[model samples]
Target: MRWTALYARSRHLTVALAAVLLCAAVLPLLLGDSWSTVFATVTLGAAVAVAGVGLSGQDLDLDRTASFRWPPRRLTHLLVIGVVAGGVMLAAQGLADLPIDSSWILRDVAGLLGLTGLAATLFGGQFGWTLPMGWAMTAALVPKAVGQAYDVVAWPMATADSAQAWWVAGLLFVAGTAAYTMAGAHR
Candidate 1:
């Protein structure tokens, strides 16, 4: 079917499965108060980005030359996927014990979506998830890595000063939009 190709190439399901599996495996320990706030938001954000990486800059030259395309442009693709990932994650909160604040979910969606977009634009979609996810993991594992010199890094905001997470998320989105939209037309 015409739609099958569209759905097939996109990696939304991959991201979703990865997110569910991660939650399944880690949710137990993250339950109660600890899992309901910024901590949970940060973890889910990275997982969601892993799947979103596939949608970034896929077969660009081929798409330009093809009769059909996955997305009209990289920016549109990222925006749609980012919003979808955010909505999905927001819905997920309803079923589980996540933060009561919608801001947390919004923050996660923005950060992960932007990070993935930027990574895919810079590193290629196949391995785009590496930087964002890696940085998030590092921040969660080693808070000292990001440093206060760059609070916009975000993941550290999970435990550091969460008030700034919104700014961090916005920065990632803006930078990622620039990267993906203005990316070199090599591919």
Candidate 2:
């Protein structure tokens, strides 16, 4: 009885997280550019949450399937979700009129890395592959996020510098890939 109650609670939490992700993805279309980037960031962040929830759910399911379930499928599913979610978020952000320079892209990439890490942690926990990936991805995103936040909120409002930002973003991309590769090495 206690176990069943816990299962129900987890299921409810999953539904709630999914709802939040949907709202995050839709905010940009609902309002104008003034709030678009922030909305997008929130939505992407929520997406990370959703992915984490999914990974946890998957992990729990595998516990039940310990008799025969494989881990590769869960990992693959996570990768696909990351790719699709990132693509949609990027396309939506691009459609908006917010600064499309390098810094903006860096922030987006950082957010994407964070989301990927969250997803991996949720789904790949059983295999001991997600922690490092999640940690590295989170690390890569923080600097860019900080820079973007400073430009947007601090005094002397700095302008977006695409070139330098893009370079940073590119470096992050390479680092993220290496982390991912290391995470999946055993698989």
The parts of candidate 2 lying over 4 Å away from their true place are: 1-21, 58-69, 91-187
User: In candidate 2, residue 52 scores what lDDT?
Assistant: 41
| TM-scores of all predicted structures | 0.68, 0.45
Model 2 TM: 0.45
What TM-score would candidate 1 get against the native?
A: 0.68
Provide backbone clash counts, one per model. Answer: 2, 3
Q: Which ten residues in a row have the lowest lDDT in candidate 2?
A: 151-160
Taken over the whole model, the C-alpha lDDT of each candidate is 0.59, 0.44
Predicted candidate 2 versus true structure: per-residue lDDT over 1-187, tens digit per residue: 6644554364354564455446434655566556634444455544544544433343454445545333454444445445554555556556654443434533554534543443344345332324323433344344445665543222112234544444444454455444443453121
Off by over 4 Å in 1: 1-4, 10-42, 56-60, 67-73, 144-151, 154-156, 159-163, 184-187
Q: Which pairs clash in model 2?
A: 55-122, 55-123, 102-162
**Residue-by-residue lDDT tens digits, candidate 1, 1-187:** 8654564455455555556456533552546455644455456655555565565335656555656543345666666666665565556566664545567566666777777777776777776667666666655554446666345554534543376666777787788767766762224
